[model samples]
Target: MAQNLDDNYKIAYDNKAGFGKSPALVLIDFADAYFDPGCVLYAGVDDALASALRIREVAHDKGIPVILTEVTYQPGGRNGGRFFEKAKPLSCFVKGQKTAGFAEGLVPRDDEIIVSKQYPSAFFGTSLASTLTAMGIDNVVLTGLTTSGCVRASCVDSMSHGFITTVVRDACGDRHPAPHEANLFDMNAKYADVVSEAEIIAFFRSLKGEAHG
Candidate 1:
């Protein structure tokens, strides 16, 4: 572990992608399917949920755009394709299913943009990139479930789409710890800067000229 975090810092992972001028916060798939304890996809993400809510409140106060993502599949799972076949749990989002809805207390406001997606990457088959680009958003603060899946995909795609990406570590969870930690390390080393929920709140506060990080 030290070999990756401590030893690689000066050479293999020297770069630190910092903050940008304009930022938008995105909560990826904080839906019932992933939060319901009875659901197979549930990852016990209580801490992540609370962290996201806190960061979101700060972001909202700072006038930073808040974007929410939810997995939605068409009838008979036609929109899901291979991903659905691989993970049948995805069927939970089928059309009118209640599990497809956003979890309690995590619903998006009427003003916030909600990206309805059927894939891991929110940017795929969604208008999120163009919307952010139109709003002149140069940074993306990510929060969501299954850190190794949608969160990881969104983080990488955020970078590939030219945004200074920051993944809130405490606001992202996974079914298992290994993949979560591994992906966080990998994403920080290459795609996004992995930061804490408090750090992100500080960043938002700084934007409002309240306090500095």
Candidate 2:
């Protein structure tokens, strides 16, 4: 008999890239576009954002660096390139649109960093990787909207850039459960260690006194 999917993948993809000594929490593209019911890009991902907020609180208390990402484009999406042309829904992110703003209660602190991009990966054409490396962050804990899009893209780039990447499953959302679950499974198997919010919170609490907010 053929092994189950999980059992079959366990043979080769079960290895874990555990948390490292230095870490940062990167919140990717949690914009109003995904939360606003009237918007075409609305994903009904409020629960995911709620879970991320909980993680953010603990991360701040633990003094772990928190980074936020946003997608933006100039008038008519002139800067979005082929991605904009391919996905008409990206028009919601045109500069100055309220839908493009960070979701409710997801504001960036004065000391936090915010990256703006026109592509899927937060690291693509952005200073995220360099900034994290400069600050000596060895592990990355990710939380964001659309697991199959920007979140997955950033996860791959995070590992490619040599960080111990971790994806908080409960804190990332997608338009549908199929892609969400599929991407999480693949990411856990090949790129990042897909974990839960509780696990991440426990890990953060364990790092007490290691850094300062």
Candidate 3:
């Protein structure tokens, strides 16, 4: 009999980081560029956004910190560096463009923190690591657009930064199912635990229960 893929990788990549004492929700680059139909970067991930919003509501009620990320480039993409030059669609994120704005229904509350960057990983060249450290956040629940890109980048960096990272499967989307599923499998194997949005919500509720217990 042939060995299944999951069984093949199970022995080596089945390790789970689980949840840490403190978890923060990080929504990466849920920008209008990915939501706007006319935009070159659009991925048509509306269901993903809806799921993330539901997760956000539960996280907010549980007093967990919510962090949002956005990408912006200067005129002519000067500050975007090699990444901007390489990814032409990134022009949608140039400063002051409507496509650079957060998609509708993702309004950040006064208490929520927004981290803007010109790169893929939310942690790269940003104060995100320091901010998480300062807040004593030990785990991260990640969601957003483009599972194969920013989400994967952020997942690896989140683990590298010493946080227990969890990627919400239903709350992330990609240009196609191929990369989306592939990246999720890879992240689950090596970087983070890929779980469902319901699992995350239940975890948050469990925290609430612990607090009130």
- Score each candidate by Cα lDDT: 0.88, 0.93, 0.92
User: Residue-wise lDDT of candidate 1 within 64-174, one digit each (tens)?
Assistant: 889999999998899898998898889889979989999888867977899999889999889999999988899999999879999988888889999999999999988
In candidate 2, stretches whose alpha carbon ends up further than 4 angstroms from where it belongs are 1-3, 210-213
Residue-wise C-alpha lDDT for candidate 2, range 121-161, written one tens digit per residue: 99999999999999999999999978999999999999999
**Best model per lDDT:** 2
Instruction: Give residue 106's error in model 1 in angstroms.
Output: 1.0
Q: Using TM-score as the measure, which candidate wins?
A: 2
In model 3, what are the clashing residue pairs, if there are any?
none
Q: Candidate 1, which segments miss by more than 4 Å at Cα?
A: 1-6, 209-213
Report lDDT (Cα) of residue 130, candidate 1.
Answer: 97
Model 3 per-residue lDDT tens digits across residues 1-213: 237877888978889889877899999999999888999888999999999999999888888899999999998999999999899999999999999999999998998999999889999999999999998899989999789999999999999999999999999999899999999999999999999988999999888432211
Model 3: residues with Cα > 4 Å off, grouped in runs: 1-3, 209-213
Per-prediction tally of clashes? 0, 0, 0
The 10-residue segment of model 3 with minimum total lDDT is 204-213
- For candidate 1, the 10 contiguous residues with the lowest summed lDDT are 204-213
